[model samples]
Target: MKRKGLRHILLPLLTAVMMLVVSACGSSSNAGTNGATGSGSGTEAASGASQEPASQTASGGTGNGEPVKVVWWHSMGGELGKVAAQLVQDFNASQSEIQVEEVYQGSYDESLNKMKASMDSKSGPSLIQVYEIGSRYMIDSGAITPVQQFIDAEGYDVSSLEPNIAGYYTFDGKQYSMPFNTSNPILYYNKTLFKEAGLDPENPPKTFQEIKDAALAINKTGKTGASFAIYGWFMEQFFANQGKDYVNNGNGRSGLATESMLNSEAGVKTLTWWKDLVDSKAAINLGRKTDDTKKAFLAGQIGMTLDSTASLRGIVDGAGTNFEVGTAFLPKADAADKGGVIIGGASLWILNNKPEEEQKAAWEFIKFLAKPETQAYWHINTGYFPITTKAYEDQRVIDNMAKYPQFKTAVDQLHATELTTATQGAVMGVFPEARQLAETAIEEAFGGKDPKAALDTAAQAITDKIATYNKTVNP
Candidate 1:
């Protein structure tokens, strides 16, 4: 699973941060927003004894020669970190031309912050894993090489990748990064609760009205019908579900985003629906943390909740005979809404500052990760669906699919999505801060403020932040 952190550090602080980084000697780790845990000791063990110099080789070596050393910085920790470490071990065992040292650089925020601090120095890793929202900042940083260059040079057929997943990383007709772990949100319902409430367990709610009705029925059973986390990510998903852009400039795909459309008709409607559910006691406000809602669902306190597919493994195991878990596509704002979800999770980016040979070696590791067999292992072990379409055909994936049929809902939802700007998701340098503002709006609405008024205030704040971001980046 993934996590969010305060990553919108101003440029002026880099000098001080860089100095501190140079003197810093210990590893740090933090839990992610996606329900994954990490240990500082595990981070130290994953990264190894000490950091390596950037220019370890005088020349790019290949095929039995001195191997090219490629350093990889990542945010995955705990069990996910172990899986990542195993993959690196497998890759190193598979080839002698490249050696990859996997480093666990805390959370997504810490990893990106370190990257920024190490930009002008040689302490940065050759390849880094950055979360989905960091795409805009990564591009604007101009310190990394676009994976498209390697793709074109090697004539790599990207057709094997899931289109919707790849669509998120593509900007200005170029693929900036190679998608690694990919996930989408889905509605997880308690099957036993549905049966108890006389709702059809097989036929889950698909629209706002249907969910509200289901929630009411489930509430009649003396349990909360739903407890949707007041997450900013879900707010964005609702806009996409209604075929509405969260920002202008084609959801920031066509060009730099200059405004926030969180106050659009779709946004107001979505918020009002959610508010109505809370007011009617059909659902409860669970604040901004998804973890709380997940716990509530597993404990049978809530009938349904919204969360990433990355949370499937833990949710299933946590339920463990207490209740049956049923998964469905995220509900649409209206029955006729045409858009779908945006992909979550991080992607792999190669640093331009690295030696060309090291970059090439890093590409090899990326290619290995994208292979069907590897992806299947990743999917089964980490709960993140594969980015490669062929991974679904692998026997392991097939077996795992049967074991947990609920997982297929996320896959179906992803494939069913239309590749539109809104569904592809919005991109902005100020996205992290914007999400916080969006969450604040949700809290205000739940606090009895008018939904439209709350959204308008948040949207204006995001617009001002966007303008400020544009000026600083483009100045």
Candidate 2:
């Protein structure tokens, strides 16, 4: 049963403080301190010092020698990170002209910090694992040379690219980065638990109420019902389903002011549902749990979880998880509530240095990574949906999905998703900090603060953060 924690009581005030602390601790903005290169928000590939500025000779700083190392940095972790490492090794072995080096740069925000720092030093790597959230910041600083230029320069086909993905990485009608791993959240359920709950294993929750119902039913078996990683990701998807906004100012990009409208009734309703679940002991509170809710779910303690498709690989490999773990599109409040979820996972951002030859080589490797076979491998191994069309068409992908149909939920959801201000993704400077605010707001409700007041405070605090960020970034 979900039990509220002590932190929940002081959530509104405490959440704001925690966000400040976390952001101060690791928030990455390319706005380096007086060009000292203190931090960059992208991954860095530690390429060996094989080619020097003079050793490389190519037009436009391409540095086309006997194929110097193309260092690539990413924010991938777990199986996702492993798959990327494997790809790097495979690329290095495939040809002698280019060597792609991969490095694990921590989580998405940490990686962004590294990338921005590298840019500040004027010696950044050629590739970074960027996300849709910071695309505006990257474009505003010109930190990234548009991947499309490389695509055009390399004569790659751009028409096959998904228009939604094109919109995701675009600003002012131009593309900046190559879309890599793209995933949205899906409901992971235990079919065996469903049967125990007297619910149909083939049927899953269809609405928020249904979600709670399923949780309550599952809890009847003396197991905790539901678990989730981050509430903001789920919140974004919730708002998308309702056609609401988390913030205005075009999702905090364009350097515009963003009002935290998540304080609205819709948001409160969503949080109230979670609070009810917690109060009902049907949902597990993450702070009090010994094992993470997802981990618990894998271990049969949790009946359900809502996480990104990236969790699929781990879920598949989880020990003592014999129940048929199934996946479905995130249930909405109603059939009329049909908006799609915002995407997660990261993208590839080319750093601002290196010769044209190395950039071309990096582009080549990225394209290779985007190939159907490579994408298939990535999806099967990492559980993130392939960003390219060819990946889905590959026979290997087909075969893998045929073997495990649960993996297809993320892909199908991405294809069916619709783009709105709410679901298009975010690009504020202090996003990680903002997420803490949302989390704290819910913590308060579970703690005993009226859900409405908690959300109002969260919205205000987030608004204040937006203003602070704009002042910091714009001024």
Candidate 3:
């Protein structure tokens, strides 16, 4: 459900924008013009604050004994934004050598675009949060300093971090960023509706055929069976669930991906099954927004739906006093499918243009955020599971899990996932645009176009974009 804004801009235009932004950085009036929009009360200091140059110090402190300042740009909004702001407040209060100012940029796409436009300027943040799909682009941009350098220099023990979550950010045996918020898709169903439809409430559908059968049964009860949003992420997850790669070159882990495998047999099977459900009146094709489908499910208009684990808190609260909400692992294309879910959400990256002291300070803040206590608070407050496994042992997290057993399903599903290239996720510089193309393909298939034909066209378009991106980065 991440909102990716704007289409892909060529690298030439991006370079020109960077030059313009850097030239404008000399103006004092434009110091913090690129700061946060009003999203959190705790981030008042980050909105239009003047930028001051820092002097080198042995302990990452300013020349006048002031704390080193670190600016963080993020895309978390609403309740999540509040939680992020609270984290920043806690970190700033807990330390004296470093101070953090958080700015809530727009969605993931907007934040990444802003970073591209400002990376060469003084207005760019020392630390920024980018979505999972932006990993390849960020790595290729040559504007980031890999967090692995800090881990190695400080001898930090990373064994506590969830491997499956960290795997997405790791490249060439090196960790590029610190995983902040991680989630996976899950099946949410109304237990009351399942009972009314005479389906087993506890035994939710485990495979595509079973889901179809359950949906047909629910529809026979004069209610809609399900409504799945036409999300491209789900399509990627389905490929992983079937132990299939979305792109070649080891899911783009070993090397740059030259093509997309979106039209493979796995892809055709998944879309055909989904389109069949809609055609047979077993499911509704809710457009591109998962929000619309969430509303329908909460209103008891649909029996089951698919959504990220991050939505568990909001969904459960919305369904309160109405019906019991049952959570299950994401359905697979076949009963024997051995693949599992890929992690969603975003991670924190350190920009290379910042001074060494500021980068070190940003690393300190990142370490504080990864602590078990902090992760537990984040997990309970927002439905995102903790990236650190030790967070599960915290009393608060334990109690929260016991109270809302649905949350445990996500953790269990993550632990059950098999670590492989497919599950680690595909990487490409043009992933944002690729997702939009995938969504278009889904819409076309729903409009009566053959699933394979639609996927082939979309896959080719993604391949072309990948080639263009590769040339831009390599040339």
Candidate 4:
């Protein structure tokens, strides 16, 4: 959808062109202000040991000469981390022309910060995996070439890519990055606990009221009830599920976002319901730590939890013998609401400062990653939905989904979701900041503050941030 707003159209053109000019003159990390509205300070902590593979020679290639080296930085860890490493190993073994070195760069927020720092010194990696929230900032950074340019130049057929998954990284009808590991939020319940509580294990809650009722019943049976992370992403998902915009200008997809709509009636209703659930002990306050909540559910202490489908493999494996992990769509705010959840995952982008050979090699690596067979392997091993439509037809994927039906929930939910502005998810440049503010509001409500007052406070703060960001980026 094209935004009617002048700023949305002009700003991107200005941002992209101006950023390129700045790079031509003298590239600096602060060159273009990333065309992002906020103060540009990264809030996430960065810490981890960055490793370099022992072999310096290109391990895989067409055997013409030394393979081109492509440096890749990512944020995956644990079992998912293992799978990512294996993919890199396989990719290296597949060809004799290009070798990719995968580096663990802490969490999403941290990696972004690190990437920016690297760009400032003109020492960034050949390719970097950035989360969906950083899409706008990445575009403005002028540090990477848009994946669309590669597609157009190579005439690569990307019709096989899932529209919803591809939609999140698209702006102005152009795809900025390649969707690699993708996921959506889902309801994960402990089937063993459900049966013990006299609830039908097969029939999971489909609405907020049903969730509350189920939680109450489970609690009455001496179980811990439903609990989830105090994640800002969940707030965005709730608003989308109700077909409500989280910000102005078509959730910032059409134009530059200037304000937050998180204080609207639907927003209040959702926050209030969340606060009441916690207040009544139907939902456990697991704080902002995702691992803590996952551990709680895996230990069978909590009967239900909401998390990304990316967590499915870990949860199922962790919950062994303790409980049967059941999956379902995230409950709607109201039974009458007609909306769906948004996709959540990171994508790959090739840096612009790299050599042409490295750039082409990076593109080759990206193409390999998107192949149906490779994506199928990734989906089955990591519980992330495959990006290509053909990946589902792979025998491995078919067998995996049949063996563990929980993994199918995300694919089913994605197929059922109605494509709309809300489900396209927010594209605001200051979205990360807005999400942090929403999380603060959630914490305040859980701390006994009035839901309306809390959201209003956050909404106003978000408005101020958006205005500042707009001015800073476009002024």
Best by TM-score: 1
- Candidate 2, residue 102: Cα displacement in angstroms equals 2.2
Clashing residue pairs in candidate 3 (N, C-alpha, C atoms within 3 angstroms): none
In the range 107-220, model 2's lDDT, one tens digit per residue, is 655566566555435565788776555555555454556887877665878776665565577655556787787666788898898999898988888788888889989888
TM-score of each: 0.89, 0.82, 0.89, 0.85
Backbone N/Cα/C clashes per model: 2, 22, 0, 9
Task: For candidate 1, write residues 368-427 as lDDT tens digits.
Answer: 888878888778887787999998988878887897889989899999999899988899
lDDT of each: 0.80, 0.65, 0.80, 0.76
Writing each residue's lDDT as its tens digit, candidate 3 over 206-241 gives 999999899999988888999998878889999999
Model 3, position 119, has a per-residue lDDT of: 51
Over 1-475, each residue of candidate 4 has an lDDT whose tens digit, in order, gives 1222443454454344433333332222111122111111111111122222222222333457888889998876555566678778978877778989999886565566667656546676899888787787777556678888879997999999999989888888999899987878899999998998899999999998999999999998887889877777888899999998889899888888888999898789988999989999998997875667877888888999887777776678777777789999999988899999888778998887787778888888888888888887777766678899998888877887887788778888998888788998887656666676788899999999999999999999888867765664576
Q: Tell me the spans in candidate 1 whose CA falls farther than 4 Å from its real position.
A: 1-64
Can you give the lDDT of residue 84 in candidate 1?
Answer: 88
Q: Given candidate 1, what's the lDDT at residue 182?
A: 78
Order of candidate numbers by lDDT, starting with the best: 3, 1, 4, 2
